[model samples]
Target: MEFLNHFRNGLVEGEDRDCFEKFLSPHVSMLYKSAIRMCGNPNDAQDLVQETLFCALKSFHQINDPEKSKYWMFSILRNLFLKDIEKTKKRAEIEFDSVCDKLTDRKHPEGDFLRAEVKSNLQEVLGKLDERLKIALVQFYFEGLSYKEISESLNIPIGTVMSRIARAKVYLKRELLRSESMRLEISKYIGDEE
Candidate 1:
């Protein structure tokens, strides 16, 4: 709520604002999580999510199907991330190690350490993935979009979506498994890649 509220410029008509609140609310957290993973830092991730939400709110009237809004919002996020990368001609400069420090100031249980390690492994693996494969994998696994939704969102055939997702899994597994510190089995979290 605060995130959207901060970005609100008071320019949207009352009715449009209400519509946006209901329409875009469900996908905001998901978008933010994806943005953080893509941007590798909370600050840039928040900016990216804000831009995505603002862009979607302005174009909410163009959305036809409510069920499809999830994919549409993701399309906006992916496009913005890719566009930023293209314009800058480089990946973000933020260091992934800083995320761990920002995640918590006080240590807790062993599970927290394990979770952080897993997240670190994932972020590193995802960073190493080819962009074409990374986008599809994030959409399916992170955003929980169906294969068809990803295909439509990326303007690719369903078969291509399946292939890219499969390829991404292989790359992730290989890289993560290669991490000596990443002893935790990824299968439980990775889902059935087959």
Candidate 2:
């Protein structure tokens, strides 16, 4: 928190901070309310709000319109919240001993080669996804965001976020199957989503 304040103050300075504050002050309450809803508890919500303010202050220089500041701040807040969740999740998911053992797996050298080939091809296939579907899928799977977070970040309905990710997965499955080598390799590992 101290680091964040120093970093922000070093960048924002005097006049710029004042101008940015004009855009931020009016919506502080609104931002707090939204943060509380998203975080599900008051303590976490307050921390999220503090982080949001620092982030918004850092990037406030780029804003060309005062009117857009509200949404901009909201976006910053949501992104910070999602990032904090992702960090916590990653830390909790890391099992050092098991991970090292898995990384050095000697059971199937050929399996590792095949997995690498499939992963490479998967990237190619992922690139073939429609833009909107691709965005939702990447955020949900890679960034580990909930459907609600994705919806808010993308400014879409939760249902729409789900639909896009579902469609993207279906499209990826069909495309992977279209490749004979990928199908032969991955089919044994992946079950039907339905």
Off by over 4 Å in 1: 8-13, 92-122, 176-194
Steric clash pairs (candidate 2): none
Candidate 2, 7: how far from true, in Å? Answer: 7.2
lDDT (Cα, tens digit) per residue for candidate 1, span 1-194: 46666665554768766766677777788888778767868888889988888888778878888677877888899899999988986564223454344433335566567657866676766666788798887668656789998998887899999999999878767787776555344444444464
lDDT of 1: 0.74
For residues 137-176, what per-residue lDDT tens digits would candidate 2 score against the true structure? Answer: 6557645668986776678999999899988988878887
**What is the Cα-based lDDT of residue 89 in candidate 2?**
47
Candidate 1 clash pair list: none
Q: How well does candidate 2 match the true structure in TM-score terms?
A: 0.50
Highest-TM-score candidate: 1
